[model samples]
Target: MDAIALLELCNYQIVFPQAQTCCGQPPYNSGEASPAKDVAWHTIQVFSDKKLPVIVPSASCAAMIKHHYPTLFDTGSTEHKQAIELSSRTYELIEFLEPILPYNKQSDSSHTHISLHRSCSALREMEVAEPWLSILRKLDGVEVSLPTLEQECCGFGGTFAIKSPEISAAMTADKCEHLLSPNPQSILSGDCGCLLNISGHIKHSGDKRPCTHIARFIAQRFGIQHD
Candidate 1:
Protein backbone atom coordinates (compact mmCIF):
# COMPACT_ATOMS: atom_id res chain seq x y z
CA MET A 1 0.00 0.00 0.00
CA ASP A 2 2.83 2.37 0.88
CA ALA A 3 4.54 1.41 -2.35
CA ILE A 4 1.50 2.25 -4.42
CA ALA A 5 1.09 5.52 -2.54
CA LEU A 6 4.73 6.43 -3.14
CA LEU A 7 4.42 5.69 -6.85
CA GLU A 8 1.19 7.63 -7.13
CA LEU A 9 2.85 10.48 -5.25
CA CYS A 10 5.50 10.41 -7.95
CA ASN A 11 2.76 10.78 -10.61
CA TYR A 12 3.00 7.20 -11.89
CA GLN A 13 -0.22 5.47 -12.91
CA ILE A 14 -0.86 2.28 -10.94
CA VAL A 15 -2.82 -0.45 -12.71
CA PHE A 16 -3.49 -2.86 -9.93
CA PRO A 17 -5.24 -5.93 -11.22
CA GLN A 18 -6.93 -7.47 -8.21
CA ALA A 19 -6.45 -10.86 -9.83
CA GLN A 20 -2.70 -10.63 -9.34
CA THR A 21 -1.34 -13.05 -6.78
CA CYS A 22 1.98 -14.01 -5.25
CA CYS A 23 5.23 -14.08 -7.24
CA GLY A 24 5.50 -17.81 -6.42
CA GLN A 25 8.69 -17.35 -4.42
CA PRO A 26 7.61 -19.52 -1.50
CA PRO A 27 7.04 -22.75 -3.44
CA TYR A 28 9.84 -22.00 -5.84
CA ASN A 29 12.31 -21.54 -2.99
CA SER A 30 11.00 -24.70 -1.34
CA GLY A 31 11.93 -26.75 -4.40
CA GLU A 32 8.31 -27.19 -5.48
CA ALA A 33 8.53 -26.46 -9.20
CA SER A 34 5.06 -27.54 -10.34
CA PRO A 35 3.01 -25.31 -8.07
CA ALA A 36 5.57 -22.58 -8.44
CA LYS A 37 5.13 -22.61 -12.20
CA ASP A 38 1.37 -22.47 -11.76
CA VAL A 39 1.63 -19.33 -9.64
CA ALA A 40 4.19 -17.78 -11.98
CA TRP A 41 2.03 -18.42 -15.04
CA HIS A 42 -0.94 -16.87 -13.29
CA THR A 43 1.11 -13.78 -12.42
CA ILE A 44 2.52 -13.49 -15.93
CA GLN A 45 -0.92 -13.78 -17.49
CA VAL A 46 -2.36 -11.19 -15.12
CA PHE A 47 0.35 -8.69 -15.96
CA SER A 48 0.36 -9.61 -19.65
CA ASP A 49 0.38 -6.09 -20.96
CA LYS A 50 3.92 -5.80 -22.30
CA LYS A 51 3.86 -2.03 -22.34
CA LEU A 52 3.70 -1.53 -18.61
CA PRO A 53 6.49 -2.05 -16.10
CA VAL A 54 5.91 -4.21 -13.04
CA ILE A 55 7.31 -2.56 -9.91
CA VAL A 56 7.60 -4.83 -6.90
CA PRO A 57 8.25 -3.33 -3.48
CA SER A 58 9.80 -6.52 -2.16
CA ALA A 59 13.24 -7.33 -3.46
CA SER A 60 12.74 -11.06 -2.85
CA CYS A 61 9.58 -11.12 -4.93
CA ALA A 62 11.16 -8.99 -7.61
CA ALA A 63 14.15 -11.36 -7.71
CA MET A 64 11.83 -14.36 -8.03
CA ILE A 65 10.05 -12.92 -11.04
CA LYS A 66 13.04 -11.16 -12.59
CA HIS A 67 15.74 -13.76 -11.93
CA HIS A 68 14.03 -17.10 -11.41
CA TYR A 69 10.82 -17.04 -13.46
CA PRO A 70 12.39 -17.94 -16.76
CA THR A 71 14.10 -20.96 -15.25
CA LEU A 72 10.71 -22.41 -14.23
CA PHE A 73 9.64 -23.24 -17.76
CA ASP A 74 11.20 -25.41 -20.47
CA THR A 75 13.72 -23.59 -22.62
CA GLY A 76 12.27 -22.22 -25.90
CA SER A 77 8.72 -22.82 -24.65
CA THR A 78 5.98 -20.17 -24.77
CA GLU A 79 5.91 -19.88 -20.99
CA HIS A 80 9.66 -19.43 -20.90
CA LYS A 81 9.43 -16.67 -23.49
CA GLN A 82 6.70 -14.96 -21.55
CA ALA A 83 8.58 -15.30 -18.31
CA ILE A 84 11.66 -13.77 -19.86
CA GLU A 85 9.59 -10.95 -21.27
CA LEU A 86 7.98 -10.28 -17.92
CA SER A 87 11.36 -10.43 -16.20
CA SER A 88 12.65 -7.74 -18.51
CA ARG A 89 10.06 -5.25 -17.30
CA THR A 90 10.04 -6.20 -13.62
CA TYR A 91 11.91 -3.95 -11.14
CA GLU A 92 12.20 -3.55 -7.38
CA LEU A 93 10.62 -0.32 -6.09
CA ILE A 94 13.73 1.34 -4.65
CA GLU A 95 15.75 0.39 -7.68
CA PHE A 96 13.10 1.85 -9.94
CA LEU A 97 12.75 4.97 -7.79
CA GLU A 98 16.47 5.57 -7.28
CA PRO A 99 16.96 7.20 -10.66
CA ILE A 100 13.73 9.17 -10.56
CA LEU A 101 12.70 10.49 -7.09
CA PRO A 102 13.34 14.19 -6.60
CA TYR A 103 15.65 15.18 -3.78
CA ASN A 104 14.14 16.76 -0.67
CA LYS A 105 15.55 20.26 -0.50
CA GLN A 106 13.45 21.78 2.26
CA SER A 107 15.36 22.46 5.45
CA ASP A 108 13.81 20.53 8.31
CA SER A 109 15.74 20.47 11.57
CA SER A 110 14.36 17.05 12.44
CA HIS A 111 16.68 14.07 12.03
CA THR A 112 16.07 10.37 11.27
CA HIS A 113 18.68 7.69 11.77
CA ILE A 114 17.89 4.23 10.42
CA SER A 115 19.72 0.91 10.07
CA LEU A 116 19.13 -0.70 6.69
CA HIS A 117 18.89 -4.48 6.32
CA ARG A 118 19.29 -5.44 2.69
CA SER A 119 17.69 -8.79 1.95
CA CYS A 120 19.78 -11.62 0.49
CA SER A 121 17.90 -11.43 -2.77
CA ALA A 122 18.41 -7.69 -2.93
CA LEU A 123 22.14 -7.96 -2.39
CA ARG A 124 22.82 -11.11 -4.42
CA GLU A 125 20.01 -11.81 -6.88
CA MET A 126 19.03 -8.27 -7.78
CA GLU A 127 22.67 -7.19 -7.41
CA VAL A 128 21.50 -3.90 -5.95
CA ALA A 129 23.89 -1.95 -3.73
CA GLU A 130 22.55 0.77 -1.45
CA PRO A 131 19.70 1.82 -3.72
CA TRP A 132 17.66 2.28 -0.59
CA LEU A 133 20.51 4.29 0.91
CA SER A 134 20.65 6.43 -2.21
CA ILE A 135 16.91 7.06 -2.00
CA LEU A 136 16.94 7.72 1.75
CA ARG A 137 19.82 10.16 1.36
CA LYS A 138 17.59 12.29 -0.85
CA LEU A 139 15.22 12.87 2.04
CA ASP A 140 16.13 15.80 4.23
CA GLY A 141 17.69 15.00 7.62
CA VAL A 142 17.70 11.21 7.03
CA GLU A 143 20.77 9.10 7.73
CA VAL A 144 21.10 5.41 6.91
CA SER A 145 23.54 2.82 8.27
CA LEU A 146 24.06 -0.87 7.57
CA PRO A 147 23.94 -3.60 10.15
CA THR A 148 27.03 -5.72 10.70
CA LEU A 149 27.18 -8.58 8.22
CA GLU A 150 24.98 -6.56 5.92
CA GLN A 151 25.38 -9.14 3.17
CA GLU A 152 24.24 -12.08 5.33
CA CYS A 153 20.72 -13.45 5.19
CA CYS A 154 18.31 -12.56 7.99
CA GLY A 155 17.47 -16.30 8.41
CA PHE A 156 14.00 -15.98 6.80
CA GLY A 157 14.45 -17.86 3.56
CA GLY A 158 10.68 -18.08 3.29
CA THR A 159 10.08 -21.80 4.11
CA PHE A 160 13.54 -22.30 5.49
CA ALA A 161 12.58 -20.80 8.83
CA ILE A 162 9.55 -23.07 9.03
CA LYS A 163 11.57 -26.16 8.15
CA SER A 164 14.59 -25.48 10.34
CA PRO A 165 13.34 -23.57 13.32
CA GLU A 166 16.42 -23.98 15.49
CA ILE A 167 18.93 -22.88 12.88
CA SER A 168 16.63 -20.11 11.77
CA ALA A 169 16.31 -18.85 15.32
CA ALA A 170 20.07 -18.82 15.81
CA MET A 171 20.62 -16.93 12.57
CA THR A 172 17.89 -14.50 13.46
CA ALA A 173 19.54 -13.97 16.84
CA ASP A 174 22.84 -13.17 15.22
CA LYS A 175 21.19 -10.94 12.65
CA CYS A 176 19.23 -9.00 15.24
CA GLU A 177 22.34 -8.60 17.38
CA HIS A 178 24.23 -7.06 14.49
CA LEU A 179 21.27 -4.93 13.40
CA LEU A 180 20.97 -3.51 16.91
CA SER A 181 24.67 -2.86 17.13
CA PRO A 182 24.26 0.38 15.22
CA ASN A 183 21.51 1.47 17.63
CA PRO A 184 19.59 3.37 14.97
CA GLN A 185 16.18 4.73 15.84
CA SER A 186 14.56 2.21 13.47
CA ILE A 187 15.45 -0.83 11.42
CA LEU A 188 14.46 -0.68 7.73
CA SER A 189 14.49 -3.29 5.01
CA GLY A 190 13.19 -3.79 1.49
CA ASP A 191 11.80 -7.27 2.20
CA CYS A 192 9.02 -7.85 4.71
CA GLY A 193 10.31 -11.35 5.46
CA CYS A 194 13.52 -9.90 6.88
CA LEU A 195 11.61 -7.24 8.77
CA LEU A 196 9.27 -9.88 10.20
CA ASN A 197 12.09 -12.08 11.36
CA ILE A 198 14.22 -9.25 12.70
CA SER A 199 11.36 -7.34 14.28
CA GLY A 200 9.79 -10.43 15.82
CA HIS A 201 13.09 -11.49 17.33
CA ILE A 202 13.83 -7.99 18.59
CA LYS A 203 10.36 -7.62 20.06
CA HIS A 204 10.63 -11.05 21.63
CA SER A 205 13.90 -9.90 23.17
CA GLY A 206 12.13 -6.79 24.58
CA ASP A 207 13.62 -4.29 22.18
CA LYS A 208 11.20 -1.49 21.27
CA ARG A 209 12.94 -0.14 18.20
CA PRO A 210 10.64 0.03 15.20
CA CYS A 211 11.29 -2.20 12.21
CA THR A 212 9.58 -1.53 8.85
CA HIS A 213 9.78 -1.63 5.09
CA ILE A 214 11.55 1.22 3.28
CA ALA A 215 8.38 2.10 1.37
CA ARG A 216 6.56 2.88 4.60
CA PHE A 217 9.54 4.83 5.90
CA ILE A 218 9.69 6.89 2.72
CA ALA A 219 5.92 7.34 2.59
CA GLN A 220 5.92 8.60 6.16
CA ARG A 221 8.72 10.99 5.21
CA PHE A 222 6.42 12.28 2.45
CA GLY A 223 3.49 12.62 4.89
CA ILE A 224 1.53 9.67 3.50
CA GLN A 225 -0.09 7.59 6.21
CA HIS A 226 -1.94 4.27 6.08
CA ASP A 227 -3.47 2.12 8.73
Candidate 2:
Protein backbone atom coordinates (compact mmCIF):
# COMPACT_ATOMS: atom_id res chain seq x y z
CA MET A 1 0.00 0.00 0.00
CA ASP A 2 2.78 2.43 0.87
CA ALA A 3 4.55 1.45 -2.33
CA ILE A 4 1.52 2.32 -4.44
CA ALA A 5 1.16 5.62 -2.57
CA LEU A 6 4.82 6.50 -3.16
CA LEU A 7 4.56 5.71 -6.87
CA GLU A 8 1.38 7.74 -7.12
CA LEU A 9 3.16 10.60 -5.38
CA CYS A 10 5.72 10.47 -8.20
CA ASN A 11 2.89 10.74 -10.78
CA TYR A 12 3.12 7.17 -12.02
CA GLN A 13 0.10 5.14 -13.07
CA ILE A 14 -0.21 2.20 -10.71
CA VAL A 15 -2.02 -1.08 -11.38
CA PHE A 16 -2.90 -3.70 -8.82
CA PRO A 17 -3.99 -6.91 -10.49
CA GLN A 18 -6.10 -9.15 -8.27
CA ALA A 19 -4.69 -12.21 -9.98
CA GLN A 20 -1.16 -11.44 -8.80
CA THR A 21 0.27 -13.73 -6.14
CA CYS A 22 3.56 -14.55 -4.42
CA CYS A 23 6.89 -14.45 -6.26
CA GLY A 24 7.57 -18.07 -5.19
CA GLN A 25 10.78 -17.21 -3.31
CA PRO A 26 10.01 -19.41 -0.30
CA PRO A 27 9.33 -22.57 -2.25
CA TYR A 28 12.05 -21.87 -4.76
CA ASN A 29 14.58 -21.31 -1.98
CA SER A 30 13.41 -24.51 -0.37
CA GLY A 31 14.12 -26.45 -3.59
CA GLU A 32 10.48 -27.10 -4.42
CA ALA A 33 10.88 -26.40 -8.12
CA SER A 34 7.55 -27.75 -9.39
CA PRO A 35 5.30 -25.66 -7.15
CA ALA A 36 7.67 -22.72 -7.43
CA LYS A 37 7.43 -22.76 -11.21
CA ASP A 38 3.63 -22.93 -11.00
CA VAL A 39 3.52 -19.88 -8.76
CA ALA A 40 6.07 -18.01 -10.86
CA TRP A 41 4.10 -18.72 -14.02
CA HIS A 42 0.96 -17.40 -12.41
CA THR A 43 2.79 -14.23 -11.38
CA ILE A 44 4.28 -13.81 -14.88
CA GLN A 45 0.85 -14.10 -16.46
CA VAL A 46 -0.69 -11.57 -14.09
CA PHE A 47 1.98 -8.98 -14.96
CA SER A 48 2.11 -9.92 -18.64
CA ASP A 49 2.27 -6.40 -20.05
CA LYS A 50 5.91 -6.05 -21.05
CA LYS A 51 5.77 -2.28 -21.44
CA LEU A 52 4.80 -1.63 -17.84
CA PRO A 53 7.55 -1.96 -15.23
CA VAL A 54 6.96 -4.15 -12.18
CA ILE A 55 8.19 -2.39 -9.05
CA VAL A 56 8.47 -4.65 -6.03
CA PRO A 57 8.77 -3.29 -2.50
CA SER A 58 10.56 -6.37 -1.28
CA ALA A 59 14.09 -6.86 -2.58
CA SER A 60 13.89 -10.61 -1.96
CA CYS A 61 10.81 -10.93 -4.13
CA ALA A 62 12.31 -8.68 -6.80
CA ALA A 63 15.51 -10.73 -6.83
CA MET A 64 13.55 -13.97 -7.13
CA ILE A 65 11.63 -12.73 -10.13
CA LYS A 66 14.40 -10.74 -11.79
CA HIS A 67 17.25 -13.22 -11.27
CA HIS A 68 15.76 -16.61 -10.60
CA TYR A 69 12.64 -16.73 -12.78
CA PRO A 70 14.46 -17.57 -16.00
CA THR A 71 16.27 -20.47 -14.33
CA LEU A 72 12.97 -22.26 -13.80
CA PHE A 73 12.56 -22.96 -17.49
CA ASP A 74 14.76 -24.55 -20.16
CA THR A 75 16.53 -22.13 -22.48
CA GLY A 76 14.80 -21.44 -25.84
CA SER A 77 11.37 -22.34 -24.39
CA THR A 78 8.41 -19.95 -24.60
CA GLU A 79 8.23 -19.69 -20.83
CA HIS A 80 11.92 -18.87 -20.68
CA LYS A 81 11.44 -16.07 -23.22
CA GLN A 82 8.57 -14.62 -21.25
CA ALA A 83 10.56 -14.87 -18.03
CA ILE A 84 13.41 -12.98 -19.64
CA GLU A 85 11.07 -10.26 -20.78
CA LEU A 86 9.49 -9.95 -17.36
CA SER A 87 12.88 -9.91 -15.65
CA SER A 88 14.02 -7.10 -17.92
CA ARG A 89 11.21 -4.86 -16.66
CA THR A 90 11.22 -5.84 -12.99
CA TYR A 91 13.02 -3.62 -10.44
CA GLU A 92 13.09 -3.10 -6.71
CA LEU A 93 11.24 0.01 -5.50
CA ILE A 94 14.29 2.12 -4.52
CA GLU A 95 16.21 1.05 -7.61
CA PHE A 96 13.36 2.19 -9.85
CA LEU A 97 12.82 5.47 -8.02
CA GLU A 98 16.41 6.63 -7.44
CA PRO A 99 17.08 7.42 -11.09
CA ILE A 100 13.74 9.13 -11.77
CA LEU A 101 12.78 11.05 -8.61
CA PRO A 102 14.08 14.57 -8.33
CA TYR A 103 15.71 15.10 -4.93
CA ASN A 104 15.81 18.72 -3.90
CA LYS A 105 16.46 18.49 -0.18
CA GLN A 106 14.12 20.63 1.87
CA SER A 107 15.30 22.71 4.82
CA ASP A 108 13.00 21.05 7.33
CA SER A 109 14.45 21.58 10.80
CA SER A 110 12.98 18.37 12.18
CA HIS A 111 15.77 15.88 12.82
CA THR A 112 15.34 12.09 12.63
CA HIS A 113 18.00 9.49 13.29
CA ILE A 114 17.40 5.92 12.19
CA SER A 115 19.15 2.70 11.26
CA LEU A 116 18.64 0.97 7.91
CA HIS A 117 18.54 -2.80 7.68
CA ARG A 118 19.34 -3.85 4.12
CA SER A 119 18.03 -7.34 3.57
CA CYS A 120 20.39 -10.05 2.30
CA SER A 121 18.64 -10.08 -1.04
CA ALA A 122 18.80 -6.31 -1.32
CA LEU A 123 22.51 -6.09 -0.61
CA ARG A 124 23.81 -9.34 -2.08
CA GLU A 125 21.33 -10.37 -4.75
CA MET A 126 19.84 -7.11 -6.01
CA GLU A 127 23.05 -5.12 -5.34
CA VAL A 128 20.97 -2.11 -4.23
CA ALA A 129 22.88 -0.81 -1.22
CA GLU A 130 24.03 2.41 -2.89
CA PRO A 131 20.66 3.19 -4.43
CA TRP A 132 18.83 2.72 -1.16
CA LEU A 133 21.33 4.85 0.76
CA SER A 134 21.27 7.53 -1.92
CA ILE A 135 17.52 7.89 -1.63
CA LEU A 136 17.64 8.07 2.16
CA ARG A 137 20.47 10.58 2.14
CA LYS A 138 18.44 12.95 -0.01
CA LEU A 139 15.84 13.36 2.73
CA ASP A 140 16.25 16.51 4.79
CA GLY A 141 17.24 16.28 8.45
CA VAL A 142 17.35 12.50 8.26
CA GLU A 143 20.41 10.80 9.75
CA VAL A 144 20.87 7.27 8.51
CA SER A 145 23.06 5.11 10.72
CA LEU A 146 24.68 1.85 9.81
CA PRO A 147 24.72 -0.88 12.42
CA THR A 148 28.11 -2.23 13.50
CA LEU A 149 27.64 -5.23 11.22
CA GLU A 150 25.57 -3.83 8.42
CA GLN A 151 26.02 -6.66 5.97
CA GLU A 152 24.94 -9.49 8.26
CA CYS A 153 21.57 -11.09 7.72
CA CYS A 154 18.80 -10.53 10.28
CA GLY A 155 18.43 -14.30 10.58
CA PHE A 156 15.23 -14.35 8.52
CA GLY A 157 15.93 -16.72 5.65
CA GLY A 158 12.27 -17.70 5.53
CA THR A 159 12.31 -21.39 6.45
CA PHE A 160 15.82 -21.31 7.77
CA ALA A 161 14.72 -19.66 10.99
CA ILE A 162 12.06 -22.28 11.54
CA LYS A 163 14.44 -25.13 10.82
CA SER A 164 17.24 -23.83 13.02
CA PRO A 165 15.60 -21.87 15.78
CA GLU A 166 18.61 -21.63 18.06
CA ILE A 167 20.96 -20.33 15.42
CA SER A 168 18.35 -17.92 14.16
CA ALA A 169 17.71 -16.62 17.65
CA ALA A 170 21.41 -16.05 18.26
CA MET A 171 21.83 -14.17 15.01
CA THR A 172 18.72 -12.11 15.60
CA ALA A 173 20.01 -11.19 19.08
CA ASP A 174 23.33 -10.07 17.64
CA LYS A 175 21.62 -7.96 15.00
CA CYS A 176 19.30 -6.40 17.55
CA GLU A 177 22.25 -5.55 19.77
CA HIS A 178 24.01 -3.68 17.00
CA LEU A 179 20.83 -1.98 15.86
CA LEU A 180 20.20 -0.66 19.37
CA SER A 181 23.75 0.55 19.93
CA PRO A 182 23.07 3.76 17.99
CA ASN A 183 19.82 4.28 19.93
CA PRO A 184 17.96 5.39 16.82
CA GLN A 185 14.31 6.35 16.96
CA SER A 186 13.39 3.71 14.41
CA ILE A 187 14.71 1.03 12.05
CA LEU A 188 13.88 0.73 8.36
CA SER A 189 14.16 -2.11 5.90
CA GLY A 190 13.05 -2.92 2.34
CA ASP A 191 11.98 -6.51 2.95
CA CYS A 192 9.02 -7.51 5.11
CA GLY A 193 10.68 -10.74 6.21
CA CYS A 194 13.65 -8.86 7.67
CA LEU A 195 11.40 -6.27 9.24
CA LEU A 196 9.30 -9.00 10.79
CA ASN A 197 12.26 -10.83 12.20
CA ILE A 198 14.01 -7.71 13.48
CA SER A 199 10.86 -6.17 14.86
CA GLY A 200 9.83 -9.41 16.49
CA HIS A 201 13.16 -9.59 18.23
CA ILE A 202 12.92 -5.97 19.30
CA LYS A 203 9.46 -6.57 20.69
CA HIS A 204 10.51 -9.73 22.48
CA SER A 205 13.40 -7.84 24.02
CA GLY A 206 11.07 -4.97 25.02
CA ASP A 207 12.90 -2.42 22.91
CA LYS A 208 11.07 0.84 22.24
CA ARG A 209 12.42 1.45 18.73
CA PRO A 210 10.04 0.82 15.82
CA CYS A 211 10.87 -1.22 12.77
CA THR A 212 9.27 0.01 9.56
CA HIS A 213 9.27 -0.71 5.82
CA ILE A 214 11.12 1.79 3.63
CA ALA A 215 8.02 2.61 1.59
CA ARG A 216 6.03 3.43 4.72
CA PHE A 217 8.88 5.58 6.02
CA ILE A 218 9.02 7.55 2.77
CA ALA A 219 5.25 7.73 2.61
CA GLN A 220 5.11 9.20 6.10
CA ARG A 221 7.63 11.78 5.02
CA PHE A 222 5.17 12.85 2.31
CA GLY A 223 2.28 12.99 4.82
CA ILE A 224 0.75 9.88 3.26
CA GLN A 225 -0.65 7.18 5.51
CA HIS A 226 -1.51 3.62 4.63
CA ASP A 227 -4.10 1.53 6.34
For residue 215, what is the lDDT in candidate 2?
A: 79
Candidate 1: give the clashing pairs.
Answer: none
Error of 2 at 181 (Å): 0.8
Candidate 1 stretches with Cα past 4 Å from truth are 105-109, 225-227
Model 1, span 92-203: residue lDDT tens: 9999987776555233427988988988888889976578778887788888888877777888999999999999999999988888887899999998788889999999
TM-score of 1: 0.95
Q: Worst ten-residue run, lDDT, model 1?
A: 100-109
How many angstroms is residue 180 displaced in model 1 relative to the true structure, after the best TM-score fit? 0.9
Span of 10 residues, lowest total lDDT, candidate 2: 100-109
TM-score of each: 0.95, 0.95
